[model samples]
Target: MSGNQGSFSLFQEILADQTQEINDLRQYITNQEQQLNTMKERLMRIRIAVLMNESVLRPFFRVPPRQRDPSYYPVIDMDLEAIEWMQANNIGGQQNAIRRFEAIYGMNLRKCKILVRTAPEEIVEAMNQRAELHYSPCYRRSLRDNSKIKRMKLICSEIIKLWEDCQSAAYPSDQIMVKRSNLERLLNEFWDGQGKKTEWFGKRKVNLSGNKVV
Candidate 1:
């Protein structure tokens, strides 16, 4: 009976030590997981910063023609000449300017409004620069086709339809606020559909939709 009791005590001691070791291993695993997550988050932030810097510096770098989508046309012609003329003539009020632009360019009300509201001179200068680049020998040889431009026009028409729908649903008292909210919701939904969430990284409470909360 004495021997059996001593063996039982020894077994208990061994079991206790095994349990402690198991607990220690679990804690170590948890710590490792946490450290890995921290490292991943830091890497993600670094990657985002790199991408942003690249986008900002992209225009300054001459991308090889082979890397560029030859069929891709980025500039949308908004009748820059008409906009420049309006700006030069001191187009007074927003409404007046939109109306005058519409008349001058035979553009629809929506296009007229968009052009009048935006920085027309900057748009003109950017378009001119892009045109020069497009006419360059390397670009001209690669992007001689107009099929992509035609497709883009169709896409633009669809976008215009969506814009008009947003406009029609917006409240007159707070048109911009309502429209912006609706657009942000749509964008969030799009991201969600793609199995992603829209994330904003900033010190301020600014969202991906450019909305700031105090």
Candidate 2:
């Protein structure tokens, strides 16, 4: 009977020791969870601070407002093709063509002249495609986001959509022209309807006269 009692007491002690160990483990786990949460909060605060600093510093780092490409100015020889097209379409002179091209594609006078003078049909086509995509409605209206990388990705996606539209068209030239009109319409609507909200994209301002990438 005494041996039985001793065994029972030993077992009770073992069980108590295990329960205490478990309680200690639970307490350690709770402290670790609290520490992890605190670290996460600190990380979030650091992220917010970094973003705030970027927002404050962005204007200073912005690319200076676009200027005309120096080499292409003066437009020495008139682009015969542009002149011919203008005559056919009753569009008038070189100045008028420049204005029309700028209004439609946001191209500068010199760039338009260069496009008109480009010898290779394929090169001209490629240039037009690039301009159309860069000035697409979706691109112009794109807003800034928290991630600059994601913002660039979104812009590229919009440009791809423009490319797809051009590729899928029955007549790529006509589709490109239509897209140009759409670009003008969308830009006008953004500027007129949204007030300064359109400036957030900065592309319109950055590429005001030509193809300078911001």
Q: Rate the local accuracy (lDDT) of all candidates.
A: 0.41, 0.44
Structural similarity to truth (TM-score) of each candidate: 0.27, 0.29
Q: Give the runs in model 1 whose Cα sits over 4 Å from its true position.
A: 55-214
What TM-score should be assigned to candidate 1?
0.27
* Segments in model 2 whose C-alpha atoms lie over 4 Å from true places: 55-214
Of the candidates shown, which would achieve the greatest TM-score relative to the real structure?
2
Model 1 lDDT per residue over 60-95, tens place = 225543344322222233333333433565543434
Which 10 consecutive residues of model 1 have the lowest summed lDDT? 197-206
Error of 2 at 73 (Å): 42
Per-residue alpha-carbon lDDT of model 2 for 63-113, expressed as tens digits? Answer: 332442222111212223434444565643446545544553344655556
